[model samples]
Target: MTSLSSEMSEPGANPLDTVERLALANDWAFHRQSDDELAAEIAGQWCNYKLWFSWHPELGVMQLSCALDIKVPAKKREKSYTLLALANEKLWVGHFDIWSEEAVPVFRHALLFRDGNNASIELMEDLIDIAVTECERFYPAFQFVFWGGKEPHEAIVAAMLETEGEA
Candidate 1:
């Protein structure tokens, strides 16, 4: 099997710089906690999302997690897990997860930049776009399961339906 390190190259750049610039360009409220960490808040149709970015220079990886505003109660945790599993299955990149400490759901993904590969503004934009879109697509499912008393499968079905045109 080919090793990941072999496929990758040496890294020395920090991706948080790019992320900070992207956050500012969009006029989003953001904080640069440190050279390696940044946080931003974005408004969506359903609710606001908290985006956190961490850059690992040694590992040559940048990780992003976008947390939804909704929270999962202890009683609804099981159903939320099931819903997350179903939602993650439909995604090509990133996965949905419950942040246990905060009991909030988040979409997480990572980018590997090796051999002098740097993150472009377009790439950062796409990363944020995809995360928010996926969260919006499934926000109702979480609500359905927690408050509407719908089963995970049923909620998934309802949330996944696409309307072709406006009435």
Candidate 2:
């Protein structure tokens, strides 16, 4: 992990610039696709996450999608959708959704920088951290539903179970 600056970006600055800096600082695999787009791959405990950041300068909104490496098969899509709904209910910041075209689950969030307000580096860091953390936390539920043949609710319960102490 890389240490992020505590500074806030200047108003009217493209947020993707900050994102690019963060990606470089962390040594994550990344590409600056355009002035408004950035894509990065981050390795997590459960899987590698594909992160896409899109900056809409006109709207002053930056959208991020952190996608899991696994794809939900057609037969498992219904259950996966259910699991996504249940998982999203637990999140305070972002929500998980299955990208219909890709059949991949992604954690999505957006930050608004309209009205000349600045975006803090801490906020950007938190956005990435939260997305990865949520994805890691819920990965097993998807696995259980897809591969373990468990029901969505059951998978959620099983994945969310926490042991009391270290062995």
Candidate 3:
């Protein structure tokens, strides 16, 4: 399978540009990919994004299926499992996702970077970063992340980049 991974950062992942979750977002794009050509090229299915809270404290990490209940702010707490595509792809995430009725595991990995999808992961990351940077300018509240792992969606969720806490 043509699998790949990438990291999305506002301002095209300059590395120099600093972005912190708690801090007010900067002027940037929110979408994961940018280039007009690339955007159009990815006409096929490419990415899926899921956001939630991790509940299994004993497990240390919670899976969406059995996430523990946490005090997710009524307004700020929400999640979605979006499949990234070309036609639907936007410069930004648009509106923040609304939480599901039940508590689910928090996003612990990058949005698109899975472990086995080496081919897809590499290519996708490049695109995701470009889009994400642009998204920041619009959606300052949304956070950019990758799919859990390279494992096909059928397999268990994995992590390209684990959502570790800030030190």
lDDT of each: 0.86, 0.91, 0.26
lDDT by residue for model 3 over 1-167, one digit each (tens)?
Answer: 13222444432232211121111132222232322111111111222222221222222221221121232334333222341121124324322222356433222222321322222234433333444333222121122212222212222122122457898
Better of 1 and 2 by TM-score: 2
Candidate 1, 40-105: lDDT as tens digits:
999999999999999887888999999999889789999898999999999999999999899999
Query: Which stretches of model 2 miss by more than 4 angstroms?
Result: none
Residues forming the 10-long window of minimal summed lDDT in candidate 2: 115-124
Listed in order, each prediction's TM-score against the native is 0.91, 0.96, 0.20
Candidate 3: global Cα-lDDT?
A: 0.26
lDDT of candidate 2 vs native? 0.91
Error (Å) of candidate 1 at residue 19 is 1.2
Query: Candidate 2, residue 10: CA error in Å?
Result: 1.4
